[model samples]
Target: MMVSYHHKNSGQFEDICVADLDYAFTNVTLPDREGRWCVGVAEGKIVEIVEGDRLNAQHVWHLDGKLLTPGLVDAHTHIDKAFTAESLGDVFAQSGLASAIQAVRHLKSQFTIADIKQRATQALQWSIAAGTTAIRTNVEADAFVELRAVEGLLDVQRSLSDQIDIQLVAFPQEGWFAIPETLESGASTYVEQALQHGIKVIGGNVNQGLWSSNPEAQVDALFDLALRYNCDLDLHLDNWDSAEAFTLPYVAQKTIEHHYQGRVAVSHIASLIHVSDSQAQVAIELLKQAEISVTVLPTRIKLTRVAELLEAGLNVVCGTDNLRDPFIRYGDADLLKALFLLAQLTGYMANRDLERLWQTISNNAAKMLRLPYGINVGNLADLVVFDAYSIPEAILHQATRLAVFKSGKLVAGTMQDQVLSLHKPDFMSPRRWT
Candidate 1:
């Protein structure tokens, strides 16, 4: 059944022929061992999913049998942080890592909304170019409310809404507990305040530095607020090196205790990555049972590896965290780099794990963002078509995204061999709760 569906993003997607459809549409689900073989997008949503026919479209584009995974969803990031970080300096532009840091350190006080807007725009555009459809970036609200970051990204969202997807994970980047714990100061109340202004609360990885007050109490307070606001949770936990930084079990326990439905995302759960084999296994089980997900920033982790943790089976999703910013430098919001690094580190770039790895960048990440459960239709009608047919080959060879569409609109595509790509696949990196 060929249905006519179109979007301003993908352009006039009409009379799509399903004669060459590869996979069965009835089983709309996360990519299995076989992966999403073929999809039928109609009316800005997947409508007619056919089993097999090679589903040639009348006015159609072919994926060349490449793995047809769902669009990417970056579960965690510091986009707003990137905004503040960018104004500090052209960290990436300066090849000298030391020079970049020095420059950024000097300008820490120079960060402004104008700088944020420019940097945010550049970051979002860079992410879009990397096949990420959706991304959740943390925005820090200082005393001034640096609303420009929100306004700039929101404008990017609206402008690229047809092509990219984004979630404003308005986060208090600094620390909720660090500001003297004064309700009058508003540091402790920042998360709630951001939520009040329509910002979703992303939890913090309260362990060291700011968490000096009392890690357990700080964490419990975050959980309590997340439960109270009924919003998603993402945190900057154990971002660097630290063995005692593991709070997954505690966080999971709190989630269960709260009986919360909102998602929990932990960035740089690097602590678990360093745990012993036995402990890692136990932690994985606990995380799985608690329905918690982890986002591992590849570049950052590369700067800080705990060994064998990559070998341990954990639901770790790769991310481009703190790109060209203060903390860690150089990442153009490229999940490709993250995926490549994941393969190098986890040794999962071989057979099934290779395919599974792709899911973390797309399907799994989208699920974490609660896409399937929300208004996920009519979203730019974008698709990432690879030049390769075999999943393993597609990844091994760094298969180019032959074509990228938004709302059925062509955003980026190769001329000779159609390689699908998107500016921000959804402005994100994929890893999900399910």
Candidate 2:
């Protein structure tokens, strides 16, 4: 019993092929664009995007006007230490950053490559299912852990390269120069080794008296390594809850001096929220001049003045910092949940604001990582179709990802037997109060 059907009102038969890209999406709305279009993907790239309901492929998915966006990007996460909260208990779960660091220190020596791989792989799988096609995770690199986390993450990266794009940062959770073990090389030496071994980015912590007694020296050391290794720099700076923990301006100055504009990213910067508007304005302008991107982790710490930074025309993106770790006892490695919390915290309720905020997890994050992103012809076909018509609707409902594609292949979510199904759930409906 063979069933033959023409593609809608076009009165043309669809071409069939036995390949991964032998599918087309019709009646799908692109973000911030009017009307629906048929997007044709082939050979891991977007080939055609025409304004009509045409199949043009073997398999046709009539989205019925669902929003199709580029796959989400989690720019900053500690996947090396993800899913470790249950074993440590509630005391460290709610504790401050110092206590969380202490707790991890006690357990770092016991972390094997296999254990790290198991936990990080699970977190990555959850992220992929949630529509994240790319991520930049920080791996701890210090005397105690040495390069164990880096080695484990490299293995996971290679294993999951087909499903998602993973970038690793050789991060020194403790200060680079504050090692007590004379038997091992300094943190800087280990970071370079990770870079030599295949890490493309260098990470630092600039909390002044905490991460490093001399923040300027630490910044110099990081920049030196980054320049020498020809890698990008990502730093954890001013994450403390005090205005006095100010090293952003210095970091910005260094970026300009080193001619490393657009090659550096800073996370947290929570102290910016405590500083005065005038001081914050100065710092924001410096960041803009340095072309440095700011990644805000809403789940892990109080957000900086996000609205003000965006108003200053600074590149401000968001990330999921931790997943069930000591620092953030609650996380699922889902950027939508992180975005929901960010929207609520920043009061981004307007339509325009929601659309712009959506970019934090998609376009902005990609731009920060220098990835070629978006739903356009010639771009990589890493896209997600959500069960919502508009950006605001998607964010408001934390919309279900109807289908997730990586390199033109279905990696997560539904898309199988989708067009043939008669029984479909109403994913757009909200819960009723009655």
Candidate 3:
């Protein structure tokens, strides 16, 4: 959309600026701001954000005093295994994470590229409707699946590039070195093969299905692949409830040793909560120094040390880990719901805490994925308009997303009509008791 603007001059007219914006959002309340503002977008980038509804463009959306924020980011998910819980049955639900991991094997072997795309597309649609525009999904990349998950998710990534940014992590769910048959054949490991096949992130699971007695060796091998591929590392460390399952400190140490600081993310470090406070602090310090991103799957783990991590001024984000899968068997892929649950679990009731916690799903996740995100000038116009006036209000209620904008285009939204109040408070009328 384009808008023609005329410049006023002394006695003569001049075309100082054309003001060819693709679209503009007016009458929207920005986070922490007092008054309504207008955001102008041109060529898929925000061009201006000025107070008051003065932006003139060919297409203008009046948000009706709703809140506007950067699009939500779901930093961690399992799209390859989404929506397969009932087939696997409720047995894993009773047994726990390990059993769930084992139960999914039967389903994983049957996953075709088309099947993965179909399930992933459904999950992505739910997430998009929930205002998430960026996601990072861990795709299984061991010899058993033989890069089928990677291949399938890459297809989904390409197909949904316009709606959402899908970052694929070549995840060796069954340990990078567990499958001897693939190694005996002298072929490259599936993780490396996946990276070569266009996955820019490497994933490791040390606590689950890891055949290697040397957990540190898996970490080393993952780092080797990450360095070899020149990609980011997202590893699952300390995922269980026991303090003895601790591997986060080692991962942090290796992150710094390999100079992978600020390029590595560790998910589900639940052991941090079980360890002594001093020990947890020591690990947190290493994480801070390494500049590692910590992602907690609030739906999957109850004790992830998110409060302490956030207090340490570390980069902490949250994700919807599994949707109707054996691992979780719940969640609608709504990241706001996950963040709300996180806020409640962490007792983040204060206004400041709630506002800051919103970053976990938006800015912090974007930082983890290294995306240029925000409702700032010159940044991609990926934003969500909420049916509320404040961050805390939105999180507290999981407010409806009025509209979602990706690259300055309207992609998904609940175009509900403006709410009407049929009954008015009759203050002048006497109360029955009175």
Candidate 4:
């Protein structure tokens, strides 16, 4: 599936100028722009992005109309949880609660570690199909049973790096406080080990499983550990329909108070939807102040809505947390669906601001995950082109991630042999663009 000839550039052409796209996007991190241009790429570095016809060189490509932008980075995720959720029965169904209860009740003899791996691989494939280049995955870690689950996700992360970038977080789904056992060998310590081995963040869950003292306390403990290690904090906060969850001002408050330098993110927190209007406004203000980021799994969060979060201008990011497991039944992994849904639900497309909420999946996500070179010159040439002529069209249709390039090399394309094929490309994994 070589990209269409339109994406190629002949250095000899007058319209083509070669340099890094970074120069073109100093203000905006990702070059989500449209124009007639050709980007000369080499050694995975974008040598230039300049107006030109096309390069006529052995290693040159001429790209036109299509915008060359940075690969997407997911702000928050639970790699294993998402992978396993898809197979664990459909939580979105009306009888979801009963089904999950039954599944858990019958889970004693039927499940094996290999099963988790299978589910994770399935989910990773879905993400690759959707153009997600990186993710901050929460893994199971706490006592031995759940810890084993997280560890298994860690293995999956390693296995799928060529297609997706993963930041494994050793997360304690159960409480660290009540899971008194965790105090002895808590997930944070495991986080230390995981980080040394490439895990990027420290993660925790509040009001669930072990040590259910206070939600804030759980997050604080994880934040403290993160600060100690100089790592990022990714917490799964109140994920229910209970307004009583987290008391007054939840994730946003802590994020601002802590003023933590490293990344601090809250995943789910659907309970925030139930927060009071006045309080929600305050939380949103605080969140912007702290620069705290969020990840919203549309397929999962749609099960519940934190309307206040949406109203507070805290646009929930679209993520496909679960692939094909218990929590989720089917998985599309296409963010365009999620983004379109978000725009419709939150009125994100009311004005030119369509690009505003668009950040939920693109630029905002990049900031949350802390990728300095996600899409820049002198970096891996990972990029995605869409079937949109204008920004508004891109948002209205939530456009297609029609083409994918790795190392300035097209790996997937909608069209055949042309610089960019306009046809919808096949969602094939490990594809080499001809």
Q: Which candidate number has the best lDDT?
A: 2
Give the Cα lDDT of each candidate. Answer: 0.57, 0.83, 0.80, 0.57
Show the lowest summed lDDT stretch of 10 residues, model 1.
Answer: 425-434
C-alpha displacement of 57 in model 2, angstroms?
Answer: 0.2
Q: Tell me how candidate 2 scores on lDDT.
A: 0.83
Candidate 1, residue 242: how far the Cα is off, in Å: 2.8
lDDT of 2 by residue, 1-434 (tens): 11122333466644323233456788887885788898877667676677878545767788877778999999999999888877677755377656666677777877889999999999999999999999999998887788899999999999999999999999987677754542212477778889988999999877764653577888999999888888999999998889989899999999999999999999989899888989999999999999999998888648888998888888888999988876678888889989998999998888889888888998889988999888876677899988777788888888888788999889998666454232335654322100
TM-score of each: 0.75, 0.90, 0.88, 0.75
**Model 3 — TM-score against the truth?**
0.88
Which residue runs does candidate 4 get wrong by more than 4 Å? Answer: 1-34, 59-64, 81-102, 105-114, 144-147, 179-198, 208-212, 247-257, 301-316, 373-376, 398-400, 414-416, 419-434
lDDT over C-alpha atoms for residue 411 of model 3: 86
What's model 4's overall lDDT? Answer: 0.57
- Any idea how many clashes model 3 has? 0
**Model 4 per-residue lDDT tens digits across residues 344-431:** 6665555456666667777777677776544443456677766654445555656676766655555555633345444544542112
lDDT at position 143, candidate 4: 40
Q: Give the lDDT of residue 19 in candidate 4.
A: 32
Better of 1 and 3 by lDDT: 3
**Candidate 2 ranges beyond 4 A from true positions:** 1-21, 93-100, 179-186, 417-434
